[model samples]
Target: MGYVLGLGGPYHHDAAACLVGDGRVLAFAEEERFSRIKHHRDSRSAAQSAAWCLRQSGIGWADIDDVAVAWNPYWPNYCDRIGDAELIAELLGPDARAAGAPRRLTVIGHHLAHAASAFYPAGVTEAAVLVVDGSGDGVSTSIHHGSPVGLRTVRELPYTQSLGWMYQNATTHVGLGDWTNAGKLMGLAAYGQPRIELPFLHLTDDGYHLDLTRYGLPPFLGADATSRYTDFSYYRDLKLAYAKAFTDAGVPAQPPGGHHPDRMAVDLATSVQAALQQAMLALATNALTLTGTATLCVAGGVALNCTSNGILARTPAIADLFVQPAASDAGCALGAALECARRRGDFTVPGPRQAHTLLGPEYSHAAIETALAAAGARYSTPDDIAAAAAHRIAAGQVVGWFQGRAEAGPRALGARSILADPRSTTLRDHVNRDVKRREMWRPLAPSMLDLTSWTTTPHGPAEAMIVAHHATDTAHEQIPGVVHVDGTLRPQRVDPQIQPTYARLLREIQAETGHAVVLNTSFNGPGEPIVATPADALASGARLGLDALAIGDYLVDLTASNTTR
Candidate 1:
């Protein structure tokens, strides 16, 4: 009967909120949609979105029983670097208005919130909880043991020694934008060789350390010097050092944007990807050694690294792994909400969520009809629209599918998606050139209705295509367009109960194409946010070379617009 609100990573990448009622997630959403900014950063903007969540739930600000912010203002020396009182006061301003402002608000540590989001929802009573990301409130990564008593932090890797930052620096060095393009660097890494200019980071019993000096950067200047500067000159220096090291190691470094052998890129990508996986495993192993836990729950920006997650799942030290769909900063909202509920003794495990990203705003049939009629577009009933969209997709025509409730995370899921026939190899190239207009090497993802039927690895608990896993040979052959060069597919296995319309569409597509999966990608062009409204769908469809627009029960004539364009 109580409502708890959680907030996390404000003014940063994936700023979001999660509202929980009696321990069940009621609504969760990212700020980017309302703010129209890639990642809502302005404190005011975050507050506005939080207000929206309250309104959407038909609750008042005073109704929030407890407010848990994902970051702790009192972590050891956190105030030393960023000063204590000011940042804490600023963050607490939003929640301070709640009914006499309850004495002693719950402030969960960044990594702990991440751990809770991962482990609690996993339905695992005992598991090793591993947290990794660019940086948390104070630490970059942490390992914890989850049990009936609650989660206990066992080991921590401070921000000074972060694997996520290393990858981010490398991502920037490779010419992609930070935050947004790290995944692109990962995909591109599959194309290069790790020159090993400096040794990759390693963890020890005392603490974590990196030999940045060996990488041609000035001696480990510690956190102060690195934190003060925003420019990436130091990273550039590291890249140069890497180039020399590659030459010495008998591996050539590919110049930025220059042509290099595909095998070379693949080898380099594999090496770094392996390094990340091994480092994560070492951390998990350490957690298991200390806690004697066989299951693992992982969350954080890095947990989105499905390859690394899959590796942990197969390790002898770990038996099961659960990664929250909104694992990044955005998910901190859910953790914060859960922390509040637990402290008030109101939290009850609401059972496992069959669908994660579906916790957002959904449009009603009347609402969608109003939009379509206002836009002067033709429409149909849900069944006819689904059938027609399925037919176009089966005919190898690209369709822009924008249905109820935009997904909360970076993934489009079935809500905001551009779908095509997975059987067409040309579909991948077509999406990149005409619609996505991004890197050619970047592969598309898949949405499978009957994920179990495909020989692909047992689909992880993903309602949104968040974690990447190896595709079975049959999957690779059947959906070549969605399969990456590495033979993996980031599939969103749709369940009928979670999204009945999406499930129905999948069934129709299966009946038409003999395959249950559709080539799915985010429903937006490069540098644009995922379409949020029916008008957005039409605008994006016209802007991008889409074959059709499916907005709820309506199917706009994209073919007519395509000819006119």
Candidate 2:
């Protein structure tokens, strides 16, 4: 009865929906999951996710007390800069506007929604909430203090000066994808050195200040004609250009596919990462000093940086840290919903989430069986699928694991993942070359049985794999497959309730090998989409280097060379 509907992203990417009642999240899903698109933008997918949320809650849309959309088109000066009035109008069309009337529609600021999604779900009362991303509404970053009085902004960092843009530019410089490959730059940074130091990274009394001129040209510079940074897409291309600039300035740009580890590359990555961490620290410290709050909530695409987050957690200014799982644009959906609930007195303070990423769609055994039968594929109903998969992994076989409800974030978790033995040192390279077809420098992540059991030396537990954590010497020796070049692992601790099936498989793998970890990657091939349908799964197995495919309850062995049909 306390349920309120949350909707986000009918007009942009990462569209999603969440239904909450009684201070517990009932159901949440991203439109991309159902649509099979990397980031859902189509109206059909957005509306379908909204409708699905209502159906899952067993309530009609009209029954909802309030409908919260994570964006406000009416924000002052919004239309003047973005010039997307038609798109905004389409988003506010009859259905969405109708849902808002009579109940009083609550239009939340895009940045505030990002901060709320991080703060409310974290169950933190007083903390520095830092929202950093490519661009939200118009701002690039915002810091806030969360308390019973609601979130209060400390300062706002405009999009014109963004650390996210710096990292994205570096990503493209190395010839990687932009929005998708920014993480690659994070990984690559560990291997490079920044030849040029810019004064813009210094902290100032006005808050964290960046001297744009020191970095050569403004990030917005057009590709051919410098000084114009476009949207996020162009933002990425500019970063790549800057990387080349670094090389031209006497810094060596690490060659793609080069087996040799270039010191310059490592130095560049270290400098940028250091600057990034310092800036974040300065921002967090300033927020705490101003708000007098010890606990912190963080969101936005930049909040996804696990390394920076770990630093924030350890900072003297912060006592505890909470981050939303879908901290990226996808989370704006839930934030939009919470904003509405706040106006109605439904969401008074932070509360515990009922579930994790498992809030997405679930397939019945019957439906999976029908798909397998129609494909004419052979499968196994093993006495224990998890154990069997563990055995295959111990034997060094790569497995495509699809189970239960899919994960809501960018991570694969255990569901919709490819699992491999971490004991194989060459596993990372092999996955990149043979399976992922991604950059060789890009490292793989591990699904650890116990996050605390592993050593997070230089950096601590990367529960979300948003940041990289150093592996304990003991862990490194035991699970060589998942370790990156810098002797770290981007790990996701499998919580029992959030990932029961994956947890069981990890337990089984540990029981056999004494190490409960697997090299887990997305369940898709290069340039292809993440497997969304049973057909997609089967097709991926047919084309890739997978040894077996586990879809729901059915287990398929692709090594047999037998076609599904």
TM for every model, in the order presented, reads: 0.87, 0.86
Highest-lDDT candidate: 1
**lDDT tens readout by residue for model 1, 346-377:** 66443463355767776777877676666666
lDDT string, candidate 2, 106-196, tens digits: 4577788888788777765566788888776557789887887778887887666677776665554444555655666666765655555
Could you tell me how far off, in angstroms, the CA of residue 456 lies in candidate 2 after the best superposition? 4.1
Task: Record all residue pairs in model 1 with backbone atoms less than 3 Å apart, i.e. clashing.
Answer: 11-41, 189-269, 190-265, 190-266, 191-265, 191-266, 192-265, 192-268, 193-268
Alpha-carbon deviation at 486 in model 2, angstroms: 2.3
Off by over 4 Å in 1: 41-44, 73-105, 192-198, 203-209, 216-268, 349-354, 459-462, 562-565
